[model samples]
Target: MSRHGTAARLSFYYAALFTAVGAHMPFWPLWLKDKGLGATDIGLIMAATYLTKIMVGPAAGHLVDRHGDRRHPMSLLAAGATLVWLLFSLVDGFGPILAVTVLAVGLWSGIFPLGESLAMMETQRHRLDYGRVRLWGSLTFIASAIATGSLLTRQPSAVMVWVVAAALGLTALACWCLPTSVAAGRGKAPATPLWPLLKHPVFLAFLATTSVGTASHTVYYAFATIHWQAAGIDGDTIGLLWAEGVIAEVVLFAFSGWVVGKLGPGRLLIIATCAGMVRWLGLGMFTAIPALAAFQLLHAATFGCAHLGAMHFIARAVPPTLSARAQGMLSAVAMGAAPGLMSPLAGRLYESLGSSAFFVMTGLSLVGAGLALFLARRWDGGTIV
Candidate 1:
């Protein structure tokens, strides 16, 4: 009944969600490397995680809409993901590993957007500060990323998957306690057509910008930890580099309400795209700490701003009944399938051009900025839905 209690529980769930991400996002490739996979193989594996969204995310969203509650499915997915992740310890071959990865990803991919849809509804109903509560997740992300990096300095590669499993275990426990006040469209007319949003010129413009622009970061997401290690950076500093970027993201989330009020989602997205261009290009050319720090600081814009704009855009433009499905679509395009589609190409470029692969990503980010800008100009001034 108390909003504060609900927010704390939500915050804990975020902490668990990102702890899994923080551990896996930066270190999974290293784990793959230790498994005797090449950069290309590693890229393909990472791509699979994103691609699984197409298979699972939208359907999960529809289920949530049908049931009118997110917590039950989230708990089931987290539990399944935990069991599947344990398979990593047993699988040695690439094919087996990919199979397990797909199972894990497809089961778990809908959790975040569903959690977000729940959080957004609470924010509207209870006037909860979405960014402030969300900041706890970022904090843990920093903690887990830094702690896991430190551990891997001496720990075995198996530690990576173990940490991921542990995090998922915690996520399953947290899901039971998440807010369940969200209303479902259950007992209403048949579900809303997602095609209407797809057909909207403005929404399509937004989707195009996100899908194409973020493709550039495929190199960084898939290989930055590996690249920096090859350049002789230690695990501690690599963790710090990851932390530095997320710290900026935390700052952005802390002030997200103000930022959204001032710039709106479209403008924020444009900024994110432009910053992404600078960050990826800089990473390709410079490996020095000062430069790396600068580029990492830009994570605020690249990831932080982009994400803030996305959630806000959904809140403002989409009807509440369609929130989960809309978020699933956003997740699939921006964070899921696009990265899935681009990572292999990034691997090819990385193998052929090494650091020069960043240049290609830079080009993609620029294209995203152009589309985002066009969308911003064409967008109607919208009130929050």
Candidate 2:
């Protein structure tokens, strides 16, 4: 495929997948509230998706790794996600909604690691820029977040069900066209056990700060929209707030190569952790538009840089053959266990402390920053050939 063809294909898939995410992340809590679930209930429900990642995400990544034909697993999982979300439009109760969310997220979560593994492979082979390609996802996220936020003004929150369902359906279709299939060594056993890899000091450190840094976002993810609403921000403005943050993230992804070349993944992670501390502290202490807007721009450092740092860590530390497995472990720890554990706590705290819950996140970021700084100082960059 031509370079443009490959980039375009990858960009399309990202757009499709994140279209649902853009809306789902910012407004799903609102939808849940519309359904009559309280803060604690919403927390548990959010946690359930992360919990699914813990139970099933690693195995799913293993399945993708075991087969060389990743396209099938990727497509099927995307299809399953679509099916689950479509069923959501029909359900009304907390139990059914919770059950559906857990199942849908499990199916949905695998697609990201699978896509990342594919992207990293292409980056190695084709000299395509990983950060540049990924920025497309961020760009689409801005569009999705803003569009969905606007829709909420004229349409009922229930309309969100259809939006999510449509996006997943599109995502499943996009999966079929994902970059030409990587060489699938059918029926081959994985050469090494996953546990030994985790025992490496560098790998262990990467996981720790990544998990903690990511966990710190739970307060924002779970409550920011609600908090903004209570503070008299309109829906469209809230959407813009989410979009503005992702725009910062997009900028980081677009220029990550230059940044990574200058500082390497260790420094990048340190920057991410420190930025997170400042961002969350500011978020907790202020609700005024200007303050929130300024802090939202820090999403570049909080989510964008942290993610690039983790990706760079994996690329450097793990064998190329084990990319999918590495992504799974990263997802399970940061995306699965930490967020799953912290999300519910954020909800409990949000209920009791109001916006003050962000203070706890400030502490989380501080710990992550301290740990990442130590790792950066001690661990020289190492790559497995």
Candidate 3:
């Protein structure tokens, strides 16, 4: 496939996928609340979903690596996710919702690492700018958040699941639009076990850095919308607040190549940790519009830079044949286990301390900064295995 064609397909997949995410991430807690679940219950449900990613990601990676295909598996997973979300309309209480969400997220989580592996492969082969293509997802995310937030104003929170289900259906279709195949040797056994990568000091540091940095957002992701709403910020404004962070993220992705070149992954991760510390601290102490707006912009550095750093690190440090697996491990640690473990604690903290829960997140950023420093010192800017 032509580079432009491949980029377009990947962009469509991202856009479709994140359209569901943009709605689900900010407002799903609201939906749970509307269904009469408390903050702790919402926290448990969110944590369960996050934890499922740990198992699903690596297992899916192993499957894709063996078959040397991502598109088909991604489509199947998307279809499963859509079906699960549609089933949500039938489930009313916390236990049923939790069970369905865990299943849905397990299937849904696998798609991201596979898609990222494909995107990075294209970046290497075709000189495709990963950031430019990824920006489309961020843009769609902004639009979805704003639109869904507006919808919630007139419609009930029950509308959230259906919108996400529709988006997931589009995502399944988009997966078929991806380039027909990856470069892996189809039907070949993986040459090495994942154990070496698991035990490697540098890889461990890399995980700790990205995982802690990303986990710093657990409290915010679980409670920010609810907190803002409780403070009389209104759903539309809360949507705008979410949009503002991703707008910054989109801008960063648009210029990611330049930034990645200038700073490298290590420095980028460090920057993310620093930005996260400041952002979380500010969020904990203030609820005023100006303070909230200013802190949200730091998301560019916190999430945008951290993600760019991890992707580039994997692209540079890991072999092509192992790309999907590496991406899965990264996702499992950074987005899965760390955040999964943190969510319940974050829920309890948010319930008891309200906005003060952000203070705990700031400490996570500090730990991530220290790990990033270690990674920068140990890594020689070359492939690890």
Candidate 4:
């Protein structure tokens, strides 16, 4: 396929996948409430999904690596997720809902790592810019979140499951449309055992750095709005502040290739962690709109740059046969386990220290920076195995 064609195909997949996420995240809790579930029940369900990702996601990755193909497995998982989501309309009460959710999320969550592995391989082969294509997912997520919120003003929240299911069905179709030629491991065993990679000190350091860097967002993700509101910021302005962070992330992604080429993964990760330190410190200390907005722009470096660094690092430093498993483990730790562990801690800190709680996150960023430095010293631009 031409570069444009390849980018378009991958872009469509991301756009479709995030549409389901955008709708489900903001409104699913409301649906659970409507179904007569309490806050505790909802928390249990959400936590179960995270647990599923931590366990099932990596196992699925290992399977993909063994099978040596991404597209077919991705298609099956997406379609299965849609079918499971459809069960929501028929089942009621906490137990049934939680059971279905665990099953569905276990399947749905695998799609991300698999899709990412495929996209990175294709972009490398085609000499295409990954961020340009990935920006579509971010754009669609924003649109979906806004549109779903708007629609909920008139429609019953009961339609939430159907809406997400529709998006999942579109995602399944998009998976079918992905470039077929990019499968890196067809009928081949992974060159490195998963255990050795897991045990490698440098690899563990890579995980710790990326996980801590990403986890530093826990307090902000959980309570930034409440903090701003307590400071007398209105709903509209708070929304704008949140939008600014995502927009900054998108802008960084739009130019990711150039940024990666200039800095390399290790330096880019170090810069991201350093940016996080400054951002969290400012957010903790200031409530003025000017300071908040200024710090918010660092979302590009803290999240966008960190993510770019991780993706490029895996591409360069992991063997091709192990790529799927590597991406899976990264997703499992950075996105799953770290956030899962930090969320409750973040809530407690926010309760005790209020905005000062952000200082703790700053400390986490500082630790991430140190780990990144350690990783840079140990891994010299080559496969760890």
Candidate 5:
């Protein structure tokens, strides 16, 4: 393929992947409710997906790195995920549904880290802008979430399976379009255990900071729609709020090159961590206020800043050959395990303490900020490779 063709195909792939997540993240809980699962059950089911990702994600990454063929694995996983979602559409009861959700999520989560590894590999090879390509994913996510929310307002929850299945099928098709052979050497290094990576203090600090910051968003992800509904916001308004956050993210992603030049990765991490502290605090306390409409705009920094900082840091802190593994570890730890462990805890806290649960999230954000500060100090002398 021509260089432009390759980039266009990859961008489309990412767009489809993010659209799938956009459909799944905000609406899956509602689907669970439609299947007769209560809040606790929904939380457990969601937690199960995360738990499986923590285990499966690293393995998938290791496979991609060792085999040096992301496309095939990605395609297989996407197809399996689509099948699981289709199965979900068939089952009605909680027991069967939870079983299906676990399988589906476990398989589904494998696609992204692998796909991201491929994108970063391409970026490194071609000197392309990762942010520019990734921004489309954010844009598609925002668009899909709003469109899906509108669809759900008129359609029953059963349509979620169809929506997700279509997205997953597109993901599989995209993966098939990706190159099959590794661009770099495929020879295996002795399987370096993830333990050594974890032992690096700066890396650990990076992990902690990003993980805690991400975990702070769990309540909003898991319950923000329900919360807004209770506060008398209509479904369409809730959809707008969700889209507002991603719209800000898309804008941030567009300007990430400038942001990276100005702030550097270290300072960006600190900014993201600090903004996250405020974001969660705002969600906890001022969500009911009209002013929060403006505060939600900070999602650009809360998610976008933190994510870009982490990816850039990973590129700097680890070797190119290990880039996929590094990202997988972050996904396993930060996105997968931390939230997996915390979601149930947050659910309990939300039930007991209600909106005050934001206090817990706020405290986690403070911890993340502290970790970011520590990483900034530790890696200050190092240069990005």
Candidate 6:
């Protein structure tokens, strides 16, 4: 295929994948509440989804590396995800819903990391810019989130399942169009086990920094709308708030190439970690303040910059063949395990400590910033590749 054709196909895949997340993330918890789940029950169910991803992502990564055919596993999993969602639409209780979520998310979550591996592989093959191509996903995420949020305001919570299912089905279709050449040929290089990598100081630092930085967002993800509602913000206003953060994220992605070039990955990480400290503090304490408009803008750095830094770190730190594994490991650590473990804690802390949970997150972000600074010294002084 021509380079332009390849890029177009990959961009479509990203749009579909991110749209799937946009459908689920903002609305899923609300749907659970609609089903009569309490706050703690909602948090537990969501945590279960992340827990499944942590357990399943590495195994899926290993399979992709072993079989050397990204298409087969990815397609099968996407199909399974679609089926799981279809099943979920029928279930009414916490037990059935949680069971389906675990099954569906365990398979559904693997699609992105594997798709990313394919995108990077194509970028390497065609000398295309990975950031430029990858940014499309961020754009799609914002667009879809806004559209879905608006739809929810007019429609029932049941619509969320249909939106999610449709997105996953489209994702599977996009996966089918991925370049067959890159899809085949599982390299014979022995799989580097995750344990040894976890033991490495640099990797541990990366894990810790990412865990703390991302954990800061857990409260916002799990309870932002609820908190805002309690504070007298209307549902529509809460949706706007969430959309605004994503819009800022989209803008950051649009400029990611220049941003990465000017600041470098390590410095960007430090900035993101610092921004996390400010963001959680703002949300935890000053969310009711009109000045929150200014603080919410920091989402660009907190999520956008942090994710960009992590992607670059994985790209630079690991070889191309192991890129899938590295991304998988990062997702499992940062998104899966860290959030899975920290989210419930954040919920509990919010119950007893109230907004002081932000102070805890603030301290964690400071630690992450310090670690990023150390990594800057370690990685900046040396050749990253």
For this target, which candidate reaches the highest lDDT against the unseen true structure? 3
Deviating ranges (above 4 Å) for candidate 6: 181-196, 288-290, 380-385
What are the models' TM-scores?
Answer: 0.97, 0.97, 0.98, 0.87, 0.94, 0.92
Best by TM-score: 3
Worst 10 residues of 6 by lDDT: 181-190
117-156 per-residue lDDT for model 2 (tens digits): 7777777677878899889889889999999999998999
lDDT (0 to 1) per candidate: 0.86, 0.86, 0.90, 0.83, 0.80, 0.78
As for model 4, its CA RMSD to the true structure in angstroms is 3.0
Clashing pairs in 1: 68-184
Instruction: Give one clash count per candidate, in the order shown.
Output: 1, 1, 0, 0, 0, 1
Worst 10 residues of 5 by lDDT: 183-192
TM-score of 1: 0.97
Predicted structure 4, TM vs. truth:
0.87
Lowest summed lDDT across 10 adjacent residues in model 1 is found at: 181-190
Model 1 C-alpha lDDT per residue in residues 58-131, reported as the tens digit of each score: 78777777668788989999999999999999998789989999998887787877888888888878887788
Candidate 5 residue-pair clash tally? 0
Which of the predicted structures, 4 or 6, would earn the higher TM-score when compared with the native? 6
Give model 6's TM-score versus the native structure.
0.92
Compose the digit string of candidate 6's lDDT tens values, residues 145-173. 77877887799988899899999998888
- The root-mean-square deviation over C-alpha atoms between each candidate and the true structure, in angstroms, is 1.5, 1.5, 1.0, 3.0, 2.0, 2.4
Better of 2 and 3 by lDDT: 3
Q: Estimate the lDDT of model 6.
A: 0.78
Selected candidate, larger lDDT, 4 vs 6: 4
- By lDDT, rank the candidates, best first: 3, 1, 2, 4, 5, 6
User: Model 4, residue 136: what's the lDDT?
Assistant: 86
